[model samples]
Target: MTATFFQRLGAVVILLWLAVGLAACSNFVKGGDNRHNIPLSGGVIQGLRNMGSSPGQGMVVRIFKEESVLEVWKATGAGAYRLFKTYEICAYSGDLGPKFKEGDRQSPEGFYTITPGLMNPRSNYYLAFNTGFPNKFDRVHGRTGSDLMVHGDCSSRGCYAMTDAGIAEIYALAREAFKGGNTSFQLQIFPFRMTTANLAKHATSPHLDFWKDIKEGYDYFEMTRTPPVWDVCEKQYIFNPAGSAPLNAAGPCPATVSNPALTAKLQADEADLANKAEAARVAAEKKAAEEAALKERGAAVNNFFSGIGSGIGGIFGGQGRPEAQTGTTTTLPTPSTQRP
Candidate 1:
């Protein structure tokens, strides 16, 4: 065979090989066995069943930024949620506040819902789901941002990032919840556990009012292990489990009654929180008073010593002066003897 003919054949063979390799890489990127496939661990499944929950049941997600914790709660057969798991966040971007605009790099803090459509199994980050930001409350306040996500890969730009293994289990749980006939699952993100102490500690923050607004929802959930039906009205979050009329995001809130027992409990809790805060404030004031008194005493002692030192120096200086010499005679000036 001619050398030129052999070269051309080799080039064709190389091109074919390249094409095959590209196709394989593409398939791998698209996921070989992991694409849209969520395999729950046997332990997880068994645990769920033991907790009176099944694979396909309603679920709720709660994230606390300060603690870097994500809690997954699943619905039991009794129509209440039980803590399924707590996953430590690998990373998250931004400080503790609501995301206001695009490119702010703020991971949002608020109530969000995730539907099946938000799932991105083919995510380059291993797995991900968008947190529906700019919801009713955000829109009412003219806040804007998009594609905020809880994703794997342990990196974040403006998202909550988890380890690949962590996200895999989270994704599986969420997917099963959807498959179990839930149209959506609630995801509540908070700066921290909305405890009375935390709120008081951050009482001077600019976001305090907003935090108080969200605390209502938090309190409701704590009182009853069920997700409160929440709606936005008058640019605020309104939660009512007693079935209120549909709310308009920009309109004023309508009057609604919450569960009476829960309401009472919440009121009592609030009163107790107020008492604790007041006690803390009083104690802090007392401490300040004591410290000020101590400082004042110290200053007085320092001033007294300083004055004594000055007086002693004056006495010694006077003793050392020519005027105070014990054995010296004074010379008087004579009358003028020369003409000026």
Candidate 2:
């Protein structure tokens, strides 16, 4: 009797909690935490130490929508950033596409710059940072949206949501980096892993062209392990442009200059990815063709057996063919016709 009572009470508690959470605007609505005051966990700090990095080093963030993951990278003594940690996204709104307007409920995918001012220690989600949506490229295209964020609460309102524990650690890292004098960090959000194979797989999607365009920046970071100094030109992302003159977002791009070694390496890598995609496409086509041929052979064999059965039926059933069958049968009276 006591156990049953306890079980009933437990169920009631869970129901009440879920009801309250679901009632909120985002479950991230209008609340806060003391978690931000805490420092990075010992485990995270040790991992940074393993990479010869400290908590206060420069940091960059990356988010992958399809994968539902976020990565935090830290600058190492080698002067290049290394992957520091990864967190699972608890929730995000909309499908895998860029946000176009306010209240679209779409999580954005693009480059954003986050400064200390963008960080929110008192966010309703516990900890949050603005994603700076509708960036230069978005503006050039006349896309509209605002207040996009990566935050804690395990729920989202067109935001990247992480568990409270996860965001606590992430927030601490950014705080320490700011104390170490880093002005701002880059946040790169992608539709997916941004591999050539993935692009090829999504070739039929309407967003392919846009993805290819952002891929230039993606390729650069993959090669250098550093966020490129990027800007908008011709309404697309351009990295490491040579001059300081402001670019016209809708105008032609200016000349770019980058490390020759890096350029060569990236070109070679791209070629390899392209080759792999092409090979996959060709293999898929070949498999489809083989399947079609197999299907055709099966059909022919079935038809052959069916025809034999029909012939046998006609001979045994006293009918020349299905169409020749009549309800009444006439006897063969050849003598009368011959005499006539």
Candidate 3:
């Protein structure tokens, strides 16, 4: 099959990004636990305290792909997590949403657990941590991938890549949390911020239903200011279930999310999203109408000049220029077909 211009252009851009990412990864110094032992900087420690959190309390990592933001939230004395820092993601591959399969080049989306064992100090790309892709939701949905990581060196094939310095601090925070006896932490990845407006913007995506399913967990965390206990049932995310019963990914969902406040919040967001979508539609139509009107006016002006040029040519017995350029249109003579 022949590739269209846009497809060819996209392939070229992807290759270029891969080249740069590989070069950046190669520049990083690897094979050392010493760098992993680097402590949190003074400014970071101070920033944590300002948010009522201290190093090693606990942490949750959230990534928003479209926004290119990775946020670190630490458990505060109040037991609720508070935003500690937001890091700019230097690189990530593929489009928004979950990875479909191995070598798909997509960075996975959805909830994951990052345990101590997932951390890698000797990573070829500075420090790194596996994202534990193909989590229950992915498995239930038959998704596949491996070695999905949040790593340094601004490189990514199917990973989230951060700058060396940015990831150093992020890795340090994770280390501190593990030292504080945390066996694992939640890693939530979203396509975007999941606001009502953002959802409205993507309401027509093929992944909208999937996104809405994940947004349940997102809403729970937003309302509670803590990671929601998540599990997969019936191939979708179920949050804060009531029972202690073990869940089967392929089986029917045994329990549903139980937060009334969050439910109310979601309902409101849906309503607001409808309004936002309508407003956006109207705005787009208005813009299109204005552009069409402008185009018509420009054409009228061009035709007026063209008529004048034709009249002048006729009056001057072809002494006027053979062609008349008007706006974006040029008039030319048709070849004679009466020759014997």
Candidate 4:
């Protein structure tokens, strides 16, 4: 049961190749999840859908603070979402958990959508992703929070904040949503409190009702792993299995958000982010180049002065004459006895 010499050599070579392949794989996977530059966009891409110039298609967004992730998913057809992409929220508020009502100063838990599109375009902040809150669900379930958005306010009062660069990518995803027919999308902003560990930690709060609703939403997400539809007027969540109830006399439960003016505002906000990003990038590069040149010039000046010093020292010390120096040098004689 002895193998031929050639056969053994082939086996050894194959083993070496396999080892090399595995090492390469290990290295490649080192930054596996983090390595993806993820295009300046977020979520899964489906070519079946196209983004039109207007934002009217149904958009669904999920914010998992626990994961520090915000994903944009676009509804292509019935029961189908082409995930636009995911973005990292650089900073979050208070505890890493869902917001409960007004003044909690925490990011709200449960489903909500953008109401008015108005944004301070001239904001000194990087950029804002305004999620119209207090939609039917928040009001009905009696949750509260307003002016909630994903913005460049790196420090958040109640909104999710990302860095200027992070918001730039988010702006793109939001714009794409509008263009792809997503006039409005749900924004589910929860703290990192959705974990089983987290739920157990806050299990005994007097505000347990609020947390209970959030947990329901979170569990629905865990089971079906889907965003809930905001039952506009009811101000509560009509879980998918529960089905949507008939609208009351209040002009449709989830008041249809027909704010064209708001849509325009969102578009403007997005444009502003794109412009600022480009400008900042250009300025940074210019500054870097200028700094480099200054360093080089400074070095050249130091070398020139050093050479002059050497020439002068040489003259008085019986070294090479100044004129024999390879680099340029100048000398000035000491003033003769001042005025005679």
Candidate 1: C-alpha RMSD after superposition:
8.0
Say which prediction, candidate 3 or candidate 4, comes out ahead on lDDT: 3
lDDT tens digits, residue span 195-217, model 3: 88898887767898888888988
The TM-score that candidate 3 achieves is 0.77
Q: Using TM-score as the measure, name the better of candidate 1 and candidate 4.
A: 1
Candidate 1, after superposition: displacement of residue 298 in Å?
Answer: 3.8
Sorting all predicted structures by TM-score, with the top scorer first, yields 3, 1, 2, 4
What is the RMSD, in Å, between candidate 3 and the native fold over all Cα? 17.3
Write candidate 4's Cα lDDT for 141-227 as tens digits.
Answer: 556877776777587888788777766655555555555554565666665545444544444445444554555455554444356
**What is the C-alpha lDDT profile of model 1 across 71-174, one tens digit per residue?**
99999999989999999999999998889999999999989878898888878898899999878899889988988999999999899999999999999998
- lDDT of residue 260 for candidate 3: 77
lDDT of each: 0.87, 0.85, 0.88, 0.58
User: Which has the greatest TM-score?
Assistant: 3
Regions of candidate 1 where Cα sits further than 4 Å from its true position: 1-38, 241-245, 304-340
Model 2, 263-339: lDDT tens digits are 77557756876787678779889999999999999999999999999989778777445445766656775555454
RMSD to truth, every model: 8.0, 12.6, 17.3, 25.5
Could you tell which candidate, 1 or 3, scores higher by lDDT?
A: 3
Candidate 2 vs candidate 3, lDDT winner: 3
For residue 33, what is the lDDT in candidate 4?
34
- Give the backbone clash total of model 1: 0
